[model samples]
Target chain A: MQFVRAIVRPEKKDEVLENLSSGGFNAATVVDVVGRGKQKGIRMGDIYYDEIPKTLILVAIEDADTDKIVDIILRTAKTGTDGNFGDGKIFISPVEEAYTISKGTKGL
Target chain B: MKEIMAIVRMKRTGATKRALIEAGVAGFTAFKVTGRGKLLDHSEINVPCKEKLMGMAASDVIDRKESEEQVVTFLDDKRMFPRRMFTILAYDEDVPRIIEAIIKANRTERGAGDGKIFVTPVNNAVRVRTGESGDAAIW
Candidate 1:
């Protein structure tokens, strides 16, 4: 299994979930976070916003589902043609194990 | 580095955070989210209305028992399981210990909503200020 964390714009969160749900991959955990990327932060005239509000959607899927899930996210998270900075980033990692607390089942 | 993501009950965030801190984890992120799992619930108010509208509209007093039975399956998909999720990045060796701390702090009962922890291997991490990457970045 792979754990995918997508840090995306707050406004794009709902749309991302909708697409994921429609894709028959509805199991996901979301969290609201604040951070900046290579761009450092956003500046508005005389104001500087160091921490931008972004939604981090966390999902665990089988290795086979990686490409499909990433495709869904990129398609729904891009800012326009060619994309834009702060469109968000998706991080993939190796999941050691997963458990269902209710049933006490492990391994995926 | 490995990322330890723990989704626990909202009420347990404080205890969980403290546990991680005591476990020598320096940095992490926490957020509020609603999810759906194996827990059974009867919180959906729309299910009854939809059923009544679909069933005999002439019955002004909808059958409570029948409505609940018909909608449990449908409502399962729509249920929201409120959770507080925490993400912690630590050295590979610290992963197990960190997870143990979280489990110790979060395991209030062995039922649904108790929570879950996912450990993922992080390929790389970068600390923007110092331009440090990999293990240094995580520390």
Candidate 2:
């Protein structure tokens, strides 16, 4: 299994989650996070919004499902057809092992 | 650089924090989260959520269904436990030390729910205040 971590604009979080659930991958952990990237931060006419709010969505799925899930996130998280900076990013890492606490079993 | 995320018991958070700081790693982020380990016995409970947030325009809140996304659900199972996810961004050399500190502080003889720790490569990180990137940003 691989863990998929997506840092997305706060507004797009729900859409991403909805897509994931409808696509049959329901288990995911969502956290409220703040970060800035290459653009550094955004500037309005008068003030700068330095720490932009983002939602970090964590999901562990079968290795085979990686592409599909990533696709769903990318499709749903982007701000528009052209995409924009701070649209957020997705990271995938191998999960050595996973266990279920209640059943006391390993590998899921 | 590598990021170490340890999800341990909420009560052990203080000890874990102390251990990390004592290990010479001062900055870290912690969040309160609810999850179930190997048990796989929990059920999801859907809680009602409104389609549009107070400050958002009705058109801005995409109408996917019932006006709100089903993403805002809660776990209804008693078996699901609450855990704290402690995240640390450090240089490559400090990864092992930080992980060790977490295990030493959170692992108890009582067993099982000591929580899980995972290390992942961070392609890059930036210090928002300084506009520094990579190792310079974290160091």
Candidate 3:
């Protein structure tokens, strides 16, 4: 199994979730987080905001399905044609074990 | 690559950020979280809050010393405290530096709740903009 975590702008959260669901990867955990990327944060009117609000979407899926899911996220979460700073990044991590709570079954 | 996750006191976030930057880390994500440690105080758990509440009326509970004690016990039993978690992705060679930076910034000589640092292996990272992967992606 693989754990995929994507951090995207708050405004693009819904669109990304919808696309992921339509792609048949439904189970996800979403969180509101504040952070910055390579560009650090943004400035407006002489004010520097270091922490920008972003939505973190987490999903656990079969290893084979990783590419498809990454594609779905990248396509839906991108801000524009070439993309911009703060467009967000996707990380893939190996999942050692997974279990279904209600069913008491193991694995993804 | 490794993912360094550090859970530290909320008040120490600024120090941690500066430390990470000075250590040459490019970016990281932080979240406000509530969590508790495994070491539970047996003394506080012995006196249940419900029994204390039963000893006094609801209105008088506010002014009584026993009520204040009860509130403390309740909080001790629940034990959850606000913490800031920083998640940083870095190359294998950078992991040690990042971990050291986090520890130096957040560690207190006091007891538990100084927080923890977990290092996990990352299979891959992708930069959405340029379609770069691996080290190129993280930097």
Q: What does DockQ give for each predicted structure?
A: 0.37, 0.13, 0.04
lDDT of each: 0.78, 0.72, 0.73
lDDT of candidate 1 over B55-105, digit per residue (tens): 753456567667555555545554456798788888878877787777777
- Model number with the top DockQ: 1
By TM-score, who's the top model here? 1
**iRMSD of all candidate structures:** 2.8, 5.1, 12.2
Ordering by lDDT: 1, 3, 2
Off by over 4 Å in 1: B1-3, B12-31, B38-74, B86-112, B122-139
| Cα-based TM-score, every candidate | 0.64, 0.55, 0.49
Report model 3's TM-score to 2 decimal places: 0.49
Clashing pairs in 1: B35-B81
Model 1: lDDT to the true structure? 0.78
Model 1, position B123, has a per-residue lDDT of 89
Q: Root-mean-square deviation of each candidate, in angstroms? A: 7.1, 10.7, 11.9
Clashing pairs for model 2 are: A99-B38, A100-B37, A100-B38, A100-B39, A101-B37, A101-B38, A101-B39, A102-B39, A103-B39
Sort candidate 1 into its docking category.
acceptable
Candidate no. 1 TM-score? 0.64
